[model samples]
Target: MKNRSLRIFLKIALSTMLLTCIRPAPAPLPVILNSPVGETITAADITFSWQAQQPAAGYIIQVASDSNFRKIVVEETVSTASANLHLKTDGRYWWRVRARNESNIWGFWSEAAFFILQRFRVVGALKTQGYPHDLAILGNRLFIADGQAGLAIYDISIPEQPRLQGKYLDSLNVAWGVKARDSLVFLAYGYKELVIINAVRPESLKITGVLEYPQPGYGYALALRDSWVYIAAGAQFIAVDISQPAYPNLRFQYYYPRNCRGIAIENAYACVACEQLGIAVWKLDTFPPRQTETFDTDGNARGVDCRDGFITVADGRNGVIFLQQDQAGHLTELAALELNGYASAVTIEDTLVFVACGSGGVAVVNCADRANPFLIATITSPYAYKVGAIPGTDYFFVLDRDLGIVTVKKEF
Candidate 1:
């Protein structure tokens, strides 16, 4: 009787072990949302959201350039069901997610969700608390007059990954524009003054000099040539000689009736974007501006750039006006490129004019046929203020008020 009872106990123990070992793990299937399988994301940045899974300790998401996910670009394990990703390429991307249980065993991946991202694909972006109005780059360093957040600097050695190197905060006034040369950074601090920052070392900035305006307005735009800094201070065009960077000396000021927002200097002449007055040409080589010419715009003249003997003006709703300035200090309208969006900032490359169109992103205008300039491509963005091209590359830098600095490849 004892032997039979022992055998029976052994049999029961084996049966219990078999049952436990054969038990299958419960895997949860998470449904996809937002990034529908067949949808396309035009922007470079994408947000992936999904339905929550039950009995999950964490989640695993993979984003690959290929549908098979053979080469993964984004593989993350998180406790949340959402992921925001920034990609460098403009093409089809496959994404999928899986859940993990307390035992550390991962469930099968959910159905792959494939999507497309094209057009003005953002490859690099720097998001900050400050409002980025305008940006200037010298070598690998990027300087900006970041509105209320003050003057900011970043390392653009890797344009796709702009790392913040330093920042100087000014609470009393707003930083409207910035220009950097050698080791000096000239910042436009409203009409209060022009603040000169010694940025030989981006981490440690020094206020080497300040040039206050005679009147109360503020400094808006600046252009530097040789050692002279031509700036737009409210309704006046002023020049400061920075031969001694530590002590900038005011040279002269030319009062104009319109508000000056942007300034561009080429050779001995400087073009000022006198709002409502359109483009104001000044002979900087002579004192008191010598001679001046103004072009008519349908609306506000917010920005200006001089390139290849052409003066491109971002004339708000008036579109973009191309003016040809002669040695006589006179400007004649060459062409006008208009878009549905408001032109806020303008830059030129070859025959292409890149205009920052507020919420409409960047509008590329073809001026090859100067007499009939027209928009060729549009890069969409939620908030865009300024668009500038990298000196040696085909990439464009966009300063977005809310999204910070965005780097886009000018493929179109």
Candidate 2:
């Protein structure tokens, strides 16, 4: 009787082990929402993300104009938990996701989430004397470089209604570019070189110091980093020391082949938009800044801005050109966005790019995907020459050659 019981128990144990080895795994859990749940999205690309479901081979996402998914706009299967898409029109959108098991069986769809897509709008505009070339925003104040009218200051504490606070007019030279920090304002004083103004009292602004570019060069655009100011001039890229505000000094100069229209400083390097020569990169940490690299664009490379290892150029007839910087600081062209007008200048606020399109007005571009930039909208202006942003906010001012300062606000 004992031998028979032992044999039966061994058989039962073997059968249990086989059953466990052949048993099927449990199905993946239902998809859960992660973002864009009843929120207002202002960008060109909308991202749909969800909690990952284990044992899922893929996922099917559906986007529609209604909660019922009757009028579907997007229905695709992706191998990941997130999907990024660009919608052509701005309106309300509802989306949901469902997982697909390894056996190709679809799971239950998650509860639908909704979002709104809206672009920016022009809130207000103010006219200025002479040509409005460049602008800068410091705190609640807006400084404009008005060609022959010199520098104009306005209070933008209230964006919709800008009030003029002060003005500085020089009969000898024109103000081409302007940048401000603290209680001082830096002006690219045309053929007169760099002029520093004491804006401690905005209502009665006065010149504090002036540094003339070594003969043959005229300041057009300027970029400020720390105590150094890099200026894109007529025939040379000039650098100035502003450590002592009242006594500005010219530091270094790099011979540029063509007219330098715009300059942007990023970390330890300075990139200049050299009219016909395209874009030139200079290393700023050296005794005398050295030109490290150069890239040619399809059209006139008028303006440039560098951030997060990427460079954006406003190519006159080509619209916008995007470039990627490698670890060694070498640049490679990624893509080009063709626009309707001549792109003279560009400014970046986070992932959005605002371009001053000569006759096409101001073109807003979404650069969330650096490799592929898309147009968000184009605000109509008689002649948009340059663009400037309010630091971290969506509030930006377009320097319209004919309209002066145009304030734009992004509604969330």
lDDT of 2 at 5: 100
Residue pairs with backbone atoms closer than 3 Å in model 1 (clashes): 190-218, 190-219, 191-217, 191-218, 191-219
Backbone clashes for every candidate come to: 5, 0
Candidate 1 lDDT trough over 10 residues, lowest sum: 27-36
Model 2, span 1-412: residue lDDT tens:
9999999999999999999987766656679999899888888588889998987999999999898999998888999999998775466889999998887778889989999777777888888987999888888899999999999999998887889999998889999999999899999988877899999888888889998744748889999988988899878888889999788888887776769999988888889999889999888888688788899898999999999889999999989999987756689999899998999899888888888999999888889998888886778899999888777686788888888888888865
Q: For every model shown, what is its TM-score relative to the native structure?
A: 0.70, 0.73
- Candidate 1 ranges beyond 4 A from true positions: 1-119
Query: In TM-score terms, which candidate is top?
Result: 2
Worst 10 residues of 2 by lDDT: 21-30
What is the Cα-based lDDT of residue 9 in candidate 2? 100
lDDT of 1: 0.81
